[model samples]
Target: MKVRTEMYNMFDGAKDYLPVGQTTLPKLYLILFLIYSGFLALWAYICNQQRKNVDKIHLVMGVLLLLLTLKIICALEDKRYIRNTGTPHGWDVAFYIFSFFKGVTLFTVIILIGTGWSFLKPYLQEREKVVLMFVIPLQVLENIASVIIGETGPATKGWFRWNEIFLIIDVICCCTVIFPIAWSIRSLAEASKTDGKVAKNVEKLTIFKQFYIVVIVYLYFTRVVVSIIGAKVNYRYEWVAVAAAEGANLVFYSFIFLNFQPVDKNPYLVLHELEEDSAASAHMWEENISLG
Candidate 1:
């Protein structure tokens, strides 16, 4: 009887200490899924009309899907179903260290976005400039929140379900980049329409487009993996991995923009002028030779 009573007491204690399950997230997930599906349908329509215009939209949608998947899996893991014991023991300290670095990484990306946008303001429309600026601060705040929730682990086992908000922000911030990128694709398409040879070279000109999509997809999946582990093992630390991924993303975008050129009006004029000048100079040389 004594042994049975002790076991019951332990069970009761465990039950009492267990983290609270999310009461509202399921509804939010349903809503998010519905909204995302609607957007996907819209993207499909756009793609049918203009393939280039939809490329960035589709890419961003994929990233959002991956982030949402991560949030859902992590939430499920936190409930301790499926026997998932997240990270190994003695990992909490390491997790915190990573979180710090990741926070710094996120902050750095925000700065880059801000500074880059400021420099690009002359080229971008006012609305695009404003949206880019808005997303920078929001993304920074979301990263800060992630760090705070991560550090709260090993105690109550869960924060205020902040990951949900972070996921939403991720979707929005990624879309900020997506909208501009999509515009670029449309610009490319228009340029191609004007010149048959340039249109034929579309494949070459847009080579970097695929890389942008691939990097965003990679980051999305990594974030999901970290979220699942954080929630499953009661270990909420994703700073280092997240930071490294974001750093890679920063570099990738830098490369993309560096290689991006205005493909419409300037190149043709410059090439035409060079050809005419060369022809005139050659004619003058031929006349001098004939006279001699």
Candidate 2:
């Protein structure tokens, strides 16, 4: 029962109720908020430079970054409030509200990325839409369960129940996400056959495969590795687990944004204006030649 409880290590003979494995979270979240704020600014500049080329997906990523930054701010304040008062209250509610929305928005962005929606294509296939319909609802449920778990704390039976529900929904969403990435890769491979753009399609396929690998790594590290760390660390050093999970999250977000940035040459995205111009020019040349 001791190990099962969320233990708060003593500091100078006084119990700290800020939650074990998360005492450093306030500082961590502060740092994360600053980092994401900077990232959001840089992202805005990049999008501005390529305004004509950016799409809904590109803008969605910016929104995700903003949500993350704001959520980090709220979380830091809430944790500080808890550390001082021995309980979650006011700001805690705001934190969870932002957290829930951020999670759902993140899931939507990831789903869109895996399906190549708004980046590589303007439309979604029926199966891809179905994936969205199912996974988005599951993500919503997972977020709800996470909030309940957070409010109840890990020591309570209610927390245990909600945590289980959270895990089940999270696992389902993870499994569901993989399908779209795999489908995109398969579609690219098939397109390479008859599209007469073998080289380009192959490049796209390689990018998709790499994205898939990164997604798997991100999920594994954040979910499994972080849990393992929390369980294995000494009681006093529980903050390490929080740091590990947050660090992984920061890296994962940075990678996704950079990899799929709205640029003319980002192989992860579809070619638009420049390619269309080239094809149009080629067609005009052929027409002129035939007339002459």
Candidate 3:
């Protein structure tokens, strides 16, 4: 009789603690993220090990996906805890850490894609590396500040906040990357007119450029516009919108990887090298004839 009474009391307490009107969408998104992350990690490892020459961009992208997967998982766990316990916990800190790393990795992937390995190497050695190092730390510091100053719960007023300001800064950084990417695409197009090899390579790069632009648009819509809507309405299910957006982003990334599987097998690799060799040979032959 005593044990039964105790069990009944515990059950009642748990019932009382359960969050009101909690939805399952966030949890569903987390499950999807886990599956995708696992698949991507396996795929990335196979590509890195099996390929004759592994592409650095693939490796970086794999790392970025993994980081994002971890961030989502942590965020999901944090949300679960809050719903069950009606209070914040250490999981929130884990979410923040993973989120910060994911952001950094995302930017790194963008830079790698925008410049390509050949150009990125020298650019990183000169000015870009220093700028990135500073920017990442500052962005993290700003996020921490926003957390401290902003409301603990969902935004109840306008979208404009210290955090939103940092998001604008991030948008500007993405815009800067677009300029370089656009220039590279234009240069490739011009070179393609005379060089068939360059044309083939340009086609491959165009696919990547299209993917990048789509992702940028998605980011702006979800990260900026959705945030504004959630804040203005103080939606009870704001996390659902965020989770849905992230799930969509992951789906897009998965589609890209599926379409462009195995970087080593890309025709661009061979064509790019051939074009470079041809250019070098032509220059050398011209110099020799002039000297003779």
Best-matching candidate per lDDT: 2
- Estimate, for each residue in 83-190, the C-alpha lDDT of model 1 and write its tens digit: 123222333333344334443343333333332232222245676657656775776667666666654543544456676677787766665655554554565567
Which residue pairs in candidate 3 collide? none
Q: Candidate 2 local accuracy as lDDT?
A: 0.79
lDDT of each: 0.44, 0.79, 0.59
Cα misplacement distance, residue 203 of candidate 2 (Å): 0.5
Better of 1 and 2 by lDDT: 2
- Judged by whole-model lDDT over C-alpha atoms, candidate 3 comes out at 0.59
Which residues of candidate 1, in runs, are more than 4 Å off? 1-122, 154-158, 195-205, 225-292
> In candidate 3, which residue ranges exceed 4 Å CA deviation?
1-22, 118-138, 149-161, 194-196, 228-236, 259-261, 267-292
Candidate 2 on 159-225: residue-level lDDT in tens?
Answer: 8888889998888888788898999999998986655445566667888888899889988898889
TM-score of each: 0.40, 0.84, 0.71
Which residue pairs collide in model 1, if any? 98-239, 98-240, 99-239
Q: What is the lDDT of residue 218 in candidate 3?
A: 65
- Model 2: residue 135 alpha-carbon error in angstroms: 1.5
Model 1: worst 10 consecutive residues (lDDT sum):
1-10
